[model samples]
Target: MTQHDTDHALKTGGEQGYLRIATEEAFATREQIDVYLRMVRDGTADRGMTSLWGFYAQSPSERAMQIIERLLDLGERRIADMDATGIDKAILALTSPGVQPFSDTHEAQRIARSANDLLAERCAAHPDRFIGMTAVAPQDPQWSAEEIRRGAHDLGFKGVQINSHTQGRYLDEPFFDPIFRALSDTGQPLYIHPGTPPDAMIGPLLDAGLDGAIYGFGVETGMHLLRLITIGIFDRYPDLQIMVGHMGEALPYWLYRLDYMHQAGIRSARYERMKPLKKTIADYFRSNVLVTCSGMAWEPAIRFAQQVMGEDRVMYAMDYPYQYEAHEVRALDAMELTPEVKRQFFQTNAERWFKL
Candidate 1:
């Protein structure tokens, strides 16, 4: 691997007898909260988005505001959480719906750059405990491409974190190729984190209290990944590596059905034709995607992900603040994986994927 801008090598923990590097950890900037608050105050915020943001919002509830304050912290408190969780290092990204919701392209670009600069400063302040990911607004693909280069090449961020969609714009659209090319040039992975679904698509699910992470998040994120695969994204940028949390966002369980359905639809001559991919959905996963055990601590999910995506593609994460620290770490320990497998899941795979 090439030399990374952060001092990742110097970051290690001897206390646990094994180094634990967690990815998929999230944080938000005060500026980010301010933007959302303004949207809410002006009655311009998406109602569904407002409901989802309440989970990590800094207003409306004093307790929720405390959590938001914690999310804004990247200093001693965060490090203490890591220590308690048995994690030595964490890869940090701006929280979901980052700048992706902004309708103004210039405003989105400004927020993306500012969030990245703040995250970079924090990582530089405590390189041993944190690694940063670039936040880009896919609303302006060309400008976002430039920010990706600026963040990864100059600011020491390891990769880019894209909230699943921009407003309703998913990454599979042809307009996002510039962003993909920029990421491809860096040889850095794109972390496809979840956001609330588009307004038109959120019907009924929200009424059932199945929005946010209960189900909507997985549905939206998983479909976004499938769109990337079936829409010839991997064919265009074959070297690109995509990362997703929540144990592949429930994709591993449906791989055979997805591949089979795609083939059946093509053979029936009933579906509209688009660009053809060089490989199947399952093949792209094997060659171009990685999954992390973030937020979900179920052994069956982890084992099933390993069975389908291979142990090498799996990594460990706590999801921080949202998921309990000690419980997840204890679950990882109790999985009884071989020492070598444990090392790959805990540290080495992350090091390899992020070029740390």
Candidate 2:
């Protein structure tokens, strides 16, 4: 935006302040260590965006480390641009493809420790503004549980982060049992972000160099979420607070198609016994899932999602470092909702969701 528009944001939005769904992976270096190590083990010259270093490099990682780091340091500048886009807080977490790249549970657990420790230390510098989302290796459920508790109770983390999918294992898979139970016991919602998709599907997508934002990221992440819903993960873990972004990843709108055709196809038997997959999905979306306005701010999408999910479940986020911070702030400010709804979307709802 323009200088005047930025000033307006500071005055109007800044006065109230918003919380950022920020990440360490956002600012991390490209995949020097992680990917180099992986290449060593695999004995091949695979140049994918597998590490934080890769994120900064353009090796087809959909990486945005440079932007994320620049944006993270732009807190004051961002506020100045927003007409008082009062960014009171930023909820931080490790970047994606975090521990998922490690093949062994033991190695993944170690990576989780290192990543979580580093994140906690960084956030310690800005306790008020930065809340931590603990990283967990879904492969080692017990260790993941221990570290999550440690992050929450010991480091004062807000919640835990699980890549949308782990090692081709969905969140609804049996491996997440301990992780789920521990999170439930501690009352911390799991913050699910997208990681690389399944290996079987990655080759074709990579051949076309369209593996991330252009198409795959949202679709892969959305599939994980769908599996979680369809498999009744929330039904099993009632208190689980699962989050999915990108305007609920096209689920809420497409829900009607399934709801109307519940009596037919592969989902029919389950629907007859389970009372319809569509209703279950809606209930899970409404009751368990929380959506953030991350990188998907089409006005109609935002308005309809808020109406469908309610302002309470919606949180404002810049997807900073990966997205244009100025644009995100402007998008929220420009939403033509009643002032009350704006307040909730801009600040209140996030405060409650992140418990800020």
Candidate 3:
């Protein structure tokens, strides 16, 4: 079927009887973009940030330009795009490398608060079509904790989005306990979105032109999640809910190996930090973590993730603007899933996880 016809069919509640609630949609405020541009100009940006945002800032390519334009729009244009792509509603968040790149704690906190306020405003303006996720500066854990509460209590945001690794520091560190405590206390899921690798890890990836979305994002984000698991983040914050996009950043496929290798490392006492956990690597995934098939519409991969992670733990995400392709929506709609399962994949799971 044609793209327009497919969209129309979905909108009209066609054979695909499910609402598409895209959970990982992204938007960026103009102020954030301006800060990114200034960082690029001043040569003070993180290497990965420079590689990703700098390219988009300067590159005149149609894809880069289109993404930039779409990222800046949170109004009718964004809603129209969603309608045209068969998405019923979107859980919106700040684009990656958000506020996490700023070394100045106050500056980062200010910008993050501004971004959260803008997102809350956009969501309120389009309550039926948009849902807001809190963005906070992890540079100051206490401030981040307070922002999380403010976003949940005052702004009505449903969850928190942290771009992976703040200034080379991962959430696995004890310093981030306040943020985790807040998330658990507030019952808001924490979506760990991908950012470009830090300086320590971006050199090789950038040299190979894979420092952005293609390879580095998954590597960095997957490592972040694994670090949380191995370091027993979930044991400390048992009530915390963590969401990872791109089919759990390919972590599901490596579950067996991860579990085995992790056990081996602990048995050998090869690393002082590798301690025993109450559960296995995969157990944490099944329990505390949720996965989204954002930018990953392939049938086999999605099905494999569902099979391994449990059907209820997997949900749909368009990865909007970055991997925006209406055909992907059509493809997901065509997956060979039973009616109930399809509904869970495209709609109910998101509603449940994000508390929509």
Candidate 4:
């Protein structure tokens, strides 16, 4: 179907007493893509990067080309796609594995700054329609912290986007405390977007052709978030808010098991890193984290997430360009949420969390 036909079929949230604010939309700059291409060519990229960006960079298929094109455009095309899908505003971030693949800290920092600048320009051009999140290279914690302050104070970005892990190093480690401090100090929520698993964990998933968004992304990112919780990140930075897409990366469904096993591990002292936390795993989720239904439009999952995560902590996202299915928007619009809850899901919650 044509874009116009899709737009016509989907009743916008405005017509249903809410505005659809898609919080996990992604965009990219050509410079960033060029760097990715170079990394793939030079054989310096990690296995996950090779599997994900290498495919995109080398694929001759029309769908791959189209996704690359869409990722590069933050102007008329992206806005039109949002309009066609009944999205009133999009909270934009650099696509996954952003600058995280660069081992050269200076190079990573430079590209991250440039990407944030370009994002700021795009958002400024259409402030009412676009909100930007800061993309930082966590390869250099101090540099990333500096960039976060600049993005929030100078560029006006709402939050910070860290694509799961940086150089196979999760943010729960002590080396990343600077970035967390910056985020807490700036009151910018951390949006942990998904990336393919690192080499240590990707071999089996890659062997099965399940290394990208199909499954590996969630498993890798969910473990990343859990690492933070178990290490008492929220207890250290009590005001640091976080967001994870794809229905909390399946975290909600496993909350009970997570709590039980986490406590068991702590009691046994099976691992040196595992320590008693200030709160249960589920409590941290309820108090510190928010979940968006990006690429997860199923009503049962959405309702279950809301029931578990609290209605206020659940929001809407389209996972644009990557999973741009107009029918997903239609499905969300057709959900049986009350007017107040629908407004919270589609609009106000994002507004409150991101300060958008």
Model 1, span 47-135: residue lDDT tens: 56777774456456766766686788989898877766668889999988899888787888888898898889999999888999999
lDDT of 4 at 339: 84
TM-score of every model? 0.93, 0.82, 0.96, 0.96
| lDDT for residue 267 in candidate 3, whole number 0-100 | 99
Worst 10 residues of 1 by lDDT: 1-10
Clashes of 4: 0
Error of 2 at 42 (Å): 4.9
Question: What TM-score does structure 4 among the candidates reach?
Answer: 0.96
Per-prediction tally of clashes: 0, 28, 0, 0
Which pairs of residues collide in candidate 1? none
lDDT against the true structure, per candidate, is 0.83, 0.65, 0.90, 0.90
What's the lDDT for residue 271 in model 1?
Answer: 57
Error of 4 at 322 (Å): 0.5
Cα lDDT of model 4 by residue, 124-191, tens digit: 99998999999998888999999999999999899999999888899988998999989988999999
Predict model 3's lDDT versus the native.
0.90
Off by over 4 Å in 4: 1-8, 11-13
RMSD of each: 5.8, 4.4, 1.9, 2.6
Residue 17 displacement in candidate 1 (angstroms): 4.8
